[model samples]
Target: MFTRNGVWAIISKDKIKDFFHRFKSFHIIVFFVIFAVGVLPCFILSRGIVANYESRAIEQRIVNIKTQCEIIINQMGMSEYLDEPSSEVINAQLTQLANFYDGRIMVIDKDYNIVKDTFSMNTGKTIVSEEVINCFKGIENSRYDKVNNYIEQAVCIEHSVTKKIIGVMLISVSTDSIVDSIDILMTKAYILQLALSLAIVVVAFYVSRRLSRPFAKISDDIAEMSEGFLNEEISVKSYREMELIVKSINKMINRMKVLDNSRQEFVSNVSHELKTPITSMKVLADSLLMQEEAPVELYKEFMTDIVEEIDRESKIIEDLLSLVKMDKTSQNLNIMPVNLNELLELILKRLQPIAAKRNIELLFESFRPVTAEIDDVKITLVISNLVENAIKYNVDNGWVHVSLNADHKFFYVTVEDSGIGIPKKSQEYIFERFYRVDKSHSREIGGTGLGLAITRNAVLLHRGTIKVSSEENKGTTFTVRIPLSYIAS
Candidate 1:
């Protein structure tokens, strides 16, 4: 039986496996860089140092041997040794030098006869070689054979009094001791390289984990958000890059949440607005059917009320359709240059009778002639909605003023009305769909509550701004500024 803790352990192991699998390529690249930069260089440098050390050691030994040969030649006096060859002191010195170097030494006279041999085997023999010949001609020479592990040196035996070469001293020494010393150094170097390689591997693993940890956290947070756990923000701020990613993700989440809430509110508002009229018509129809002996006037009045409800329902649906069309993100605009003054005049002409019903004055003032690129149908609807609302909500005998003007880059329209203005707090949400400042008054005036929403969306589509200034119970003013050209982005 698996417990909760055991199940969580399995999930954690799976996450770890996924993390490594995702970053396997990165980890491999990091390891390769560490080996190339740290281990490979160390190995090459150590090998070069060992070879150099061996070479220098051999040169120093050769120098010492050459000095000893010169001293012996001076003590014996090259002419005297060549004539007699019987100096016990010089012989003893040659023997001691050969033993110290662990090799053979021979002294040859000008006639190529071995006058002295430290090994005692080549004594009284004739020695001929290129090194010895070169030495006698005043050219010193040395040879080191790495494969055979030996060094051979030839130095001239010059007489101290005459300072002239007479014979040659040949020394051949085994390089086994130098080779042994190098072997020790190479072994130590190999051990050091192994330790350094291990360190590099450890550091590579640590750095890779630290760098990938933020991505892993982001992945987990996104997964949790997908599972409907989005009440909290993603807070991964380990690195600068991660901080930017987290901030962007949080902003997207907020936008999605707002859209979701707006969608729910819109649906609820649509249901209520549609149901109210149908219910009213149903009540009126039931009343007519209940009165079997009703008079002609009563029947006509009930039928008129039902017809009015149907018309109100129809208006709401038409406004809803307009809003839905405006809400489409990819809707195309039928853009054209429109005369702003004429458009306002036509809108005022249509609303004149409605203003006349309340004895309110409808006026239009044009500061300058203006033409602008706009979607005619949508913009007409926007202007009409604002003016219609102004007339509908105005006090009796109050004035509704519509004005038009133009600037270098933009055209402006203002709609001011002597009406019951919106509350300060309600003005902020006036453009929201189905929002009403006075719900009972809105119903009495047959307001659909979608007029300002449609107006705002239309203005925004034209790359314009709308601002409302109002004080409750005094009046309201709406100013619109739109660009002269339509540039599709």
Candidate 2:
């Protein structure tokens, strides 16, 4: 449904976009900049100088010829050249002046009668014209006719004693030499401009290529890395900006290498964990099958062991599923304004029975009535996991304290427990999936080791932070901060 103008506009826009995409290169940009900076001023200056020379040359020549005409007119007034009409001295002077300038002169007396002509064709002729008429009225006049390439001047002749207008001298001088000189100058200027432009092009090409060479090499290296060569580093150190780019890209490469290794380890760990329970179930089944007449109580006990192994396998799979869901939450968040105080109280109430079994105390405190924008289910899971972990890992009769507070921008949740705290060496990795500080103790407590990882991921999805400070055999504190307003990524 596009109008004609709209279709043409789209076509022109696409053409311009395609042109820029094809020619988008540092070398092309630099080359144009250098050529512009170096050559445009030189061109303008050469044209200006040529034009100025043409004008000044014509003007000076006219002034010189006019001075000569004035002197000759004065000489005629002092002598009888106009009356006699054949004075040899004045006639020779006029002829010499005309020959020197390659021009014509006409001396016209009062009453519009031509007394003498240098070319001799207009002698004794009546010549009435604008310049001649104005000159007789005591006003001098001169003009340049560029199209005809000549200078015309009209001067008044006055008697020496009377100072009255007696005659007029009309001078027409050729400016052909000045034009010829200008033509030669224009040719030379154009030649100079062409040579300068050529030099600028050469220098622009060389410099732009030199500057862009390192980026080309870096691009090749990055292309290689994209094909599973992440271990290699890009080593371009030509310019300061190049060094900074290399540093940033190398850091990203290191992070990518770490991520790849983590993925490999995760796959290995999953296979081993999944196989262990199946192997145990097979061993128990083999033992039961080997007995020819196994007792009912013994079969029940063996079957119980198998059921526990299956439950363990199922738990591991469930936790893995939870982790996978946490990883893909970009579009799955059911965000709403949730009251932090009530959410924390409900989590503590739910975990209270588990804590009671351990003879551990569960407590909740609210510094202020806190509310924030968050996914209620995810945040509920996060708090439940932290409090439950605190209870499971704590000492008998130990107290687990949960506190909620808020500021103008964010709400804070703190869980402090008198638990067998994590060792400093293992603290950094506590949030990694399936990682355990004390593997044997973790198994005894039936921990799947995905709780903290899930908690951390959920917090991150809400653009929040979680930190832990622990001293072994003393106590541990986990602090979480989340903004009151949800900002989607």
Candidate 3:
């Protein structure tokens, strides 16, 4: 039952609301600026121009009427009409002038008696108004009534020869013509202003759209990326700010992709690692179960193998839990001041037995006394992993060196070992979770492949850096640098 206009109105309202919701900021600013700078000023200027025109028109009308009054005054004086009060020539002139201007005229003698009336309504009457009295004293006066649309002027008539006042001439003229012209001008100006306002609105909308288009594109790109469609970078180059935003967003997306891939790989590796141990344990269990009356020594051997597999599985799970905990503890570092030399000594002491079992000599040398603010437990884990790996990978009778040095800002620890070193290409990926240069060797050595990764995360959490240098058959050295003081960000 709706009319076409009503339906259109509803649709238009909905569209406006949608636009406001989408680009409210830019639209609000653009509309306000256009109205304040364009439409509002145009309206004020139009009103000012109309007012000036009306003022000039009123002045011109007053001048024309005064000129006619002066001409009539001269004629009346020369023909002695003011004294006689019955001159047909002067009265006819006055009546014609009044009729032409759609007004009335009156001629008053020195004693304030009306000598001639253009309308013939106040003849033979004595007038005692202020304007007439002031006119007799040689003062000319005028008054304009805008609401009534009229103007009145009072002038003194002088004797032509003696230059003495003889009578007062008062002319009252209608201002309807001037007012009508002004009204017409204002109407046209208002129409023009309305047209300009519409144009301004169009321009404002266009400007707002252009300004907001880049952000809209960015939003779309982000949405696509969220839906796993991030094969390329966002290329919104309309503005410098948009370019920066796009670059930052693209970087973040790339990082997220890398993390996602790493996560997938880590999960697969965990399953494989856990399954291998469980498989071994199952085989060992089956071997014992199949032999009902197995020898005590044989049973003990099988049980030991099963316990070893269980231990390996437990180690893998524990490392995974440690990695998860480290990820969560990135921001919550329990920082305290500790002696770096003492901390390294303690780690080496704990790892000395493992190194001795492999006949690897453990040596520690402190170049300078060093104290730094760090998380004690995490730092201990980092150093322990490094020194332990060095010891584990060392040859028999090989030496492992642990050294510490310090400067004004930072302290350094170097752990070097005469061990089978990593490949040059593999060094870059050593800190990646579950990465191993030789899977069989790693298994034989009982490495979970999560040690270096945990070490790197712990060092990074303390705002430190660790670097590794190695050769194929020579040795590997890990250098660690940590700041002397903890500065929380």
lDDT of 1 at 58: 93
lDDT tens string, model 3, 39-110? 888999999999999889989998999888888788776768888967777777888999999999988999
By descending TM-score, how would the candidates be arranged? Answer: 3, 1, 2
Q: Report how far residue 399 has shifted in candidate 3, in Å.
A: 0.6
Instruction: State residue 461's C-alpha deviation in candidate 2, in Å.
Output: 4.7
Model 2, residue pairs in steric clash: none
lDDT order of candidates, top first: 2, 3, 1
Cα deviation of 80, candidate 1, in Å: 5.1
lDDT of 2 by residue, 394-426 (tens): 899998999999899999999999999999999
Best candidate, lDDT-wise? 2
| Alpha-carbon shift of residue 295 in model 1 (angstroms) | 5.7
Question: Candidate 1 residues 1-489, lDDT tens each?
Answer: 569889999999999999988656655666667668877888899989998999899999888777877777677664487657777777778888888888888888888999888888887899889998898889999999899988999888778788788888888888899999999999999999999989988887787667777878888999999998767888997889779989999999999989999899899999999999899989988988898998999989988988989999999999999998987843689999998888889988988999999999999999999999999889999999999989887899999999998889999999999998889999999999999988998998999999999999999998899999999779999999999998686
Output candidate 3 Cα RMSD: 6.4
Highest TM-score: give the candidate number.
3
In candidate 1, stretches whose alpha carbon ends up further than 4 angstroms from where it belongs are: 1-45, 75-143, 286-299, 329-331
- Scored by Cα lDDT, where does model 3 land? 0.88
Decoy 1 TM-score against native: 0.82
Model-by-model lDDT, in order? 0.88, 0.89, 0.88
Summing lDDT over every window of 10 consecutive residues in candidate 1, give the lowest-scoring window.
23-32
